[model samples]
Target: MIALLRGFLWLTGFWLAGESLVVLLDLPISAGVVGMLLLTIALLLRIGRLEDIAAASQPLIGLLAMLIMPGVVGVFFVADEFAGQWLAVAVALVGGTLASVLTTLLLMRRCMPAAPRTETPQETSS
Candidate 1:
């Protein structure tokens, strides 16, 4: 219970700091996205531990599907515009997905250490 409160406070503090930095720099990026990125960096640096926030985050994470409701609803309003630009939308979707996948692969390759190769028993027999 205490850990959950601490986690919430930590997340809120980090988010406000990131948002303020974005506003101060006059960055075009969204504050929420910047906050999320900051949180990710903190986690990667071990400054924020998942376990510390797991309790509080668990319910919110579980209800994440509900959060998509607005996006799903918004899509209906854009359906006509999307249909008119289907080809461009398709291209953008594919390009964005590919770019995201490539970026993720590159980041993982750089951040994670490669596993040591192990010799098979048959090769040892030789």
Candidate 2:
């Protein structure tokens, strides 16, 4: 419980800091995105340890899955507009998904060290 509270407060502080920076800079980007970036940087720098936030992180991540439903509902509400721009929306969705997947894969590959290669039986025989 204490760990959870600490995680929540830590995340809240990160979010507020990002939002404040956005307000001060008058950037067009979303505060949430900024907060996420800040959190990622903090984690990379070891400023925020994963174990310290694990309890809250687990529940918060799970809760985020539920939050997607609201986005689906909003899409339904804007169905007419979407239908009118269906092709453009489809292209954007496909492009964005591909870009995101590629970016994630690239980042993971770069961060993770290559596994040691083992010689196959054919190579040994050769």
Candidate 3:
């Protein structure tokens, strides 16, 4: 429980810091993204270990479907605007998914190649 609270507080602190930066610097990016960047930096700097936040974030990530429902509902409400552009939306979604998959495959191939296997020949019995 204490670990969960610490994680929540840590995440909140980073999020608030991000929002504060947005306010101060007038960045076009959203505060949540800035908070993510801060979190990444903190991890890379060894200041914030991922284990500290994993407990708190895991359950929240599981609730993603519920969390995203509102956005989905909003999209449904805007369906009228999208009705005429259905083909464009379909193409965009499919193209983006294919591009992302191909890019990930390419990166994995470059970054994580499989170990080579060596085969030995068997001697035939006389």
Candidate 4:
């Protein structure tokens, strides 16, 4: 519980910092996104260890689907607004998903070490 509290504090501090930056700079991006970017930079810089905030973040990560439910449901209420834009929305969703997957794959390929080549029995015997 203490660890969780500490983690939450770290997360909240970054979020507040991000909000402040957005307000001060008039950034068009969401504060949460800014906060996450700041957190990523801090982690990369070794300003804080991941363990310090993992406790708080893990639970939130688990609740991701549930957290997104409200937005999905809210769209239902405004369904009429999307009546004629379904094709565009579908294209955007599919394109975004493909782009995200492609980006992940490319990043993973770049960051992960190459696998060692294994010799087959025939090659070894020869």
Residue 38 displacement in candidate 3 (angstroms): 1.3
What is the Cα-based TM-score of model 4? 0.68
Q: How far in Å is the alpha carbon of 49 misplaced in model 4?
A: 3.7
Listed in order, each prediction's TM-score against the native is: 0.56, 0.63, 0.69, 0.68
Better of 2 and 4 by TM-score: 4
**lDDT of every predicted structure (CA atoms):** 0.82, 0.84, 0.85, 0.90
Off by over 4 Å in 4: 91-126
Which portions of model 1 miss their true places by more than 4 Å?
40-50, 91-126
Per-residue error (Å), model 1, residue 16: 0.9
Count of clashing residue pairs in every prediction? 0, 0, 0, 0
Which of the numbered candidates is closest to the native, going by highest TM-score?
3
TM-score of 3: 0.69
The regions of model 2 sitting more than 4 angstroms off are: 87-126
- Model 3, residue 126: distance off in Å is 50
Candidate 3 per-residue C-alpha lDDT over 19-67 given as tens digits, one digit per residue, 9 for 90 to 100: 9999999999899899989988998898865777877788778998999
lDDT by residue (tens digit), candidate 4, 52-118: 6899999989999999998888876877976898989999999999999999999999998875566
32 in model 3: Cα distance from truth in Å? 1.3
Q: Which stretches of candidate 3 lie over 4 Å from their true place?
A: 48-51, 99-126
Top lDDT prediction, candidate number? 4
Q: Per-residue lDDT for 37 in model 2?
A: 91
Global CA lDDT computed for model 4: 0.90
Flag the better candidate by lDDT, 1 or 3: 3
1 against 2, candidate with superior TM-score: 2
